[model samples]
Target: MIDFTKRQKEIMTILSKHEPITAEQIAEMLGVSKGTLRSDLAVLVMTGQIEAKPKVGYYLSKNMQKQKQQDIWNQTFVKDIQGVAITVKGTTTVNDAVISLFLEDVGTLIVVNEHNELEGIVSRKDLLKVTLGNAQATSMPVQLVMTKQPKIYTIEAEKTVFEAAQMMVYYEVDSLPVVKPVENSQALKVIGRITKTNIVKALIEMGSEA
Candidate 1:
């Protein structure tokens, strides 16, 4: 089962009762800063639990509300959304990894060891700092520059898509590594990835049907 923090639950309750409300209103009611409210709102939005309107404010979308209810009732993980993950070896050169990111049109890549265990993650932003400084990508190894042992987030293959969506939102990341249970120490293998683009595509498809 997916777990939410007390603060997140409180935020959800507030939005449910008085949605289409501004971040300011939420902050004032919760006795918190606008920044904190915004962060909480971002998590809800990313999880598809709530939506923000430009001038109108924030509201719990109909789909999300229904989904939440369904989750509480049946508590099933819907596997409708899916995507493939691209990975690179930790020993790969920075230049090669950069090329892979471009070719895949993805913002992140999971770095693995020879045993197919997740070693680290490299993101476009991580490479950007070095790339902009005129450093030779060829000379730099991905291991030297990549984010080591990043907080790896994952969802069960059978879990609801929203679970993965929520994790991405909570962590403020673009993608999540899909994994399967493995042995000790390296207990998960990178199997796939989920991104904001994938979530948007699913939403668009749902909208098109309506």
Candidate 2:
């Protein structure tokens, strides 16, 4: 069953008792503005917990359990679903990076320095653009072809997978490096990586388990 928020439960209860109540009335009883309940009402309607009548008010749906749905990944932690990141030193040759990318079956590689701190990320597209016609460039360091620090997108281990997915879509990235802040420093330490594939696989796994 889908878990309802506290306010949503109260709204459901209000609807049950009132049978059909307007949004303004519900907001007044809850001591909040109707705008505050707008999203909550939308969710309830979409999830089939409640229904709205034109020129009328909202009513609790009769078949609540039939419409029940769970957002399994909404509150899931990135750390729980992330995969081990394939990493290379920034100084690693492009040729070796390519080999690692293929061997690991991953599209991107995390590039770090001796400290194992995140330096940059190199993707197959970046490598392809550089090594397409120029064979000699294969010996070049990955740092040259990598999208450097401050530009690389990363997520915290504690962040929800939903937030990670949002970042991926907004940034137009296939994956994100999961990171943890270093002690007393602004530097980020690579933890793992969350990819579109990882998210999909997790959804499948969670669904199967359920």
Candidate 3:
């Protein structure tokens, strides 16, 4: 789960044999500088793997079971990686999409219909290809340039972040629209997004929690 470094694992091993250990003792045993230990210890403490008592010492938390840590790492819910999804209506002009792209500072825009149901996706490259030199390109509807349904890739909130990442790599895209499938309808409602950057943010948060 929290892919600990070899030195960090050794630090844990040392703590396992001793109920509580001093920071100095850990650094000496691991042959690492206090500065290095500080970072490792911070991650350990942040992840709840170890507890530090001021003026006392560091001790492994009783609740830090291996299985518990594994369970936390196994979480795949897309909501765990959810972030704001920038969108534009299919009827919006390419010019407007460009403006939104610049205004929002996002690489792609989710295109939706009147009901806010997913219709397609537009990327910077998509806009560039059609609008780069054409004077009338700006007036064209975004839907005309978007990668529409049956071609665009999407992820569900219930899916795992790993799967989301996999889809991005497979599709050679930087992001995926997070959607909710209607029980009886053919449409999906766009809710959020999970991007490569979102994955990095999630990992950072996980490290912080760790």
Candidate 4:
């Protein structure tokens, strides 16, 4: 399914009951300005879920098959929309970590070894807790405050987006490191990072294709 947003579904329902309704009337019923819904209407029209005419107004499209639009949200892999991971070495100082945080504009940084294997994860909040009251801690290694291996949560590169989303909700995390198994060793390589923002972007992109 296209995973229609609540507003989009409501608009469809209104069209089903009152075919050929104008955008203004739909916006008025929903208590929002027509401009606010322009994008939503455009998406519906582009996806073939709804149709519009110059003099007539809007109506539900009967040609579209809801099921065949299928379940991209559930079947897509983490690698499909994953972004490059912002990385830092475990030996990196807390001061430098802060600099990387701002420079990278990422909430989490994957800690890696010289071989580029996953070692730990340090977040913006972790940096704050370590440097909040004690200025001396800025000189300390980030490993001291990072969530190290065996404790850090990660998602496999091939895992489904559905699984990634479920893990994020259950763990209450904003992002996860995307890892791939290393040959002849148990260590995992940090290939990418997946965040809530990435998931949202994926949904929006896929929704448009529907």
Best by lDDT: 4
The residue pairs found clashing in candidate 4 are: 1-70
Put the candidates in lDDT order, highest first. Answer: 4, 2, 3, 1
Model 3 Cα lDDT, one tens digit per residue, 6-48? 9888888787666478999898888878888998899999998
Q: What lDDT tens digits, residue by residue, belong to model 4 across residues 108-198?
A: 8899999889999999899999888899999999989999888888999789888999999999999999999899998999899999999
Could you tell me the lDDT of residue 160 within candidate 3? Answer: 80
lDDT of 4: 0.89
TM-score of model 2 (CA atoms): 0.68
Quantify how close model 4 is to the true structure by its C-alpha RMSD in Å.
10.8
Q: What is the overall TM-score of model 3 with all chains considered together?
A: 0.67
| Candidate 1 ranges beyond 4 A from true positions | 1-79, 207-210
- In the range 36-151, model 2's lDDT, one tens digit per residue, is 99999999999989999987899878685233213455658898989998899988999999999999999999997777799999999999999988999999999999999899
| Winner on lDDT (1 vs 2) | 2
Taking the tens digit of each residue's C-alpha lDDT, what string does model 1 give over 4-101? 67887887778766776888888888898999866777877888778888999988878967865555424423345658878999888888988998
Off by over 4 Å in 3: 1-73
In the predicted model 3, the residue pairs found to clash are: 46-210, 47-210, 76-160
Error of 3 at 103 (Å): 0.5
Better candidate number, 1 or 3, judged by lDDT = 3
- What TM-score does structure 1 among the candidates reach? 0.60
Clashes of 2: 0
lDDT of each: 0.75, 0.88, 0.86, 0.89
